[model samples]
Target chain A: MLEVRGIQTFYGNIQALKSVSLSIREGEIVTLIGANGAGKSTTLMSICGVTPPRHGEILFRGQPIHRLGAEKIVTLGICQVPEGRHIFPQMSVLENLEMGAYLRQDKAAIKADVDEVFERFPILGKRRQQAGGTLSGGEQQMLAISRALLARPTLLLLDEPSLGLAPLIIKQIFEIIRKINAESNTTVFLVEQNANQALKIAHRGYVMENGAITLEDRADNLLSNEEVKKAYLGI
Target chain B: MDSEYFFELLCGGLVKGSIYALIALGYTMVYGIIQLINFAHGEIYMIGAFVAFIVSGVLTLTGYGGPTVLLLAAVIAIIYAAAYGYTLEKIAYRPLRAAPRLSPLISAIGASIFLTNYVQLAQTPDFLPFPELITDFDFMEPFSRYVSSVDLVILVVTTLTMIALTVLIKYTRVGKAMRATQQDAVMARLVGINVDRVISATFIIGSALAAIAGVLIASRTGQINSAIGFMAGIKAFTAAVLGGIGNIPGAVLGGLVLGIAETLGAGYISSAYEDVFAFGLLVLILVLRPAGLLGKAVKQKV
Candidate 1:
């Protein structure tokens, strides 16, 4: 489980996240839904130590990880697939995947995981030799997820995986997220603006406004709430 | 314009270009990873030559002359240069990683000035004689008319180093991490690459290449001074810019072209105007293509 307690994050003088807190238990798919620039990505970034919160603490499995470096956080079994599918543009798809397993020493297991990733996403296997920048948007998103998965992370933090993808591809991606949670029992902390699709897959959800968490409830309950329906779901 | 004379001049140009390429790679690779010009890179080369000079002096005094002393001196110079490079980054640029872009650039210039003065005060400011580490080879007798054993050695050593570097950047784990960091530093951290260590490795590798160039040039030219790195560094930096600062192959091509152009201009035109040709070509390249010969014109995201 991960616990974020009263964290404030900033960029220079401007505060991006203020007094924000959230929690996720193991093996659960939790989505944070908000409109644009509501500090959803900042929450994940703070958790990953990319931009450590200026105040407050983050505990992962009862260990204080808020002060750790970004790579240290990853070494502790947390991997992030950042927004916009930031794959290495010049590297081949295979090379990108190799980078995902950069810290693991278990070569045999890494290779097995790679094979499994390829088997699950055959299109990626077909385009293994192609440059990552040349891949279509959906394929790049898949590569980004596959790259993070190669880390064999216990906690997978996904930020806007459905952004800029076709509706059909988005459906496939959501299905994959659900299947990953079911099969591997991996804890997923998903941040997205697509509240409808995200809540549909999430077991629980939090609604964020500005830089604070406004509401938290079971996914179905939040989906049916009047304010959540009008503001995020556009019902 | 006799063919023999042309060939001799061409050989000389290649010898000079190989040295430039070795040093230029340092500039290009460092720039590729972090967008700093690393103004103090030349000082690392100077430090390398000085270390070799001191080590070879002590070795010669102890009656350890010839290739063994040469090899020992070169190896120590390389190791010392790498250490200096690592320390320099830790002190000069690492702390300013999040500072304004101009802060690191200014810090690099400051480090350069400080190192240059430190060397001048520690060692004599005058030129010192460097030993002829590379002796004459009997196999080169047939071609000695156009190139000496030293020139051939420089060419061969530089070629081998280039091949090794190419392999390091292409297939090695550290190289892949370096490439990943270069593309996306934040994502690289997400995948568990210690980015600070990667930057340190870049400095180490780049400094090693510069040290190689320093020792070879000191041996060939027969003399070195505290200020040798200044001109060589400028020329190599120019070469990097010419090829495209962040492009690997561009650095090699740029160094060779700059070396050949300068040499030919000196040979054909007035020897006093050698630099005019070099800077002239740079200005021409800048006017025609500001992004450089091999550099793409994409807008860099802040």
Candidate 2:
């Protein structure tokens, strides 16, 4: 479980996140839907301590993690598949996956986890020796997710997993995301512009606008809400 | 010219190229990881030579000489150089990690100047003779007349070190972390890798390689001074750029090519224009292939 309270994040003079707060209980898929520049990615980054909130506290499993370094935050079982699928371009797929388990010393478990990732994304297994950058956009996204999964994270944060992908690939990716949550009971905090696909799979959802969370409701309720349908669902 | 004479020149070129390869690795590796040119790297090589010079002198005075003492002195010099590299990164480069790119570059140049002067002040400005270590053996007596034991030593040491480095980067966990950091620092940190430590390790490994090169070059040339690093550093930097600055194998190839070109140019054309040949190759490479021979054209994803 995670709790974020009154976090304000800034990018120099511009305030990117204003008192943004949200929570995710264990074993739930929570998606944050927003338009461009809605601070969805910023919220995930702040929780990961990449861009720490200047005025808020983030607690993971009842422990304060807002002040820790990004690397330390990862060791505490949180991983992010960053926007744009920032896979190590020159490294092979297997090496990228190895990097996911960087902090773990248990070699046997790491190997088994890698096997699981290969099972989930068979194309990644096929291209295990190929450089990450050489993969297709959808394949790269799969690699990014597979890499994060190797870390054995308790909470996985996915930022725009469907960005720059075909609709069919997006559908497959969302299906995988759902499969991951359902089978492993993994807590997922997804940030997305594709509200329709995201809310359909999410147990709960939040609508962000102008760096603030403007609405929070159950996924089905938000899907039927007239204002939500007008502003985000495009009904 | 006789075939033996040409062979001699070829051997000499290889020896020189091996030295350049070692120094170029330092330049290329550091630049690859941090995107900092690390102008101070050449000075680290200079210090390594000086350390070996002092250690050899002490060893001789204490009645210790020969191959064992020589090897011991080289080891000490390498350890000292690695330490200097660690401290230099911590002091000169770490603080400027988040600053604008130009800041660390300027700081690196400043560090280079400070190190060069520090040596000049601490020791002497005069060119001191490097102790005779491995010159006694005739390593290539059966095969070639011109190649000596020192040349053999340089080639062997360089080859072994490069192989070790390749293995370290390819098969090791830490090396994977380094490659990850090089590709994306933020993502690397997100995976629980200490980016600072990886950067520091790069500096340490690069500096150690340069240290061995300095000792070998000093032995081959028979003398060294504080200003030696200036020309060597520039040439090695040129070699790194020539081979594609961030590419490791490219650095070695560039170094060997530069060394052969310079040596052959001097032997065939004129000695006075030897440095010109090296610089000319650099310009030619930049004009023809700006990314260096092995450097790939990186596409900027917007």
lDDT by residue (tens digit), candidate 2, B247-269: 99999999999998899889989
TM-score of each: 0.97, 0.97
Candidate 1's residue-wise lDDT over A57-126, tens digit each?
A: 9999999999999999999889999998898988888999999999989999988988998999999999
Pairs in clash, predicted candidate 1: none
iRMS, model 2 (angstroms): 2.1
| i-RMSD values for every candidate model | 3.8, 2.1
Question: Is model 1 an incorrect, acceptable, medium or high docking prediction?
Answer: medium
Go through the candidates in order and give the C-alpha RMSD of each one to the true structure.
Answer: 1.7, 1.6
How much native contact recovery, as a fraction, does model 1 achieve?
0.75
Judged by DockQ, which candidate is best?
2
TM-score of 1: 0.97
lDDT for predicted candidate 1 compared with the true structure: 0.92
lDDT of 2 by residue, A90-181 (tens): 88889989898888899999999988888878888999998888889999999899889888888999999999999999999999999989
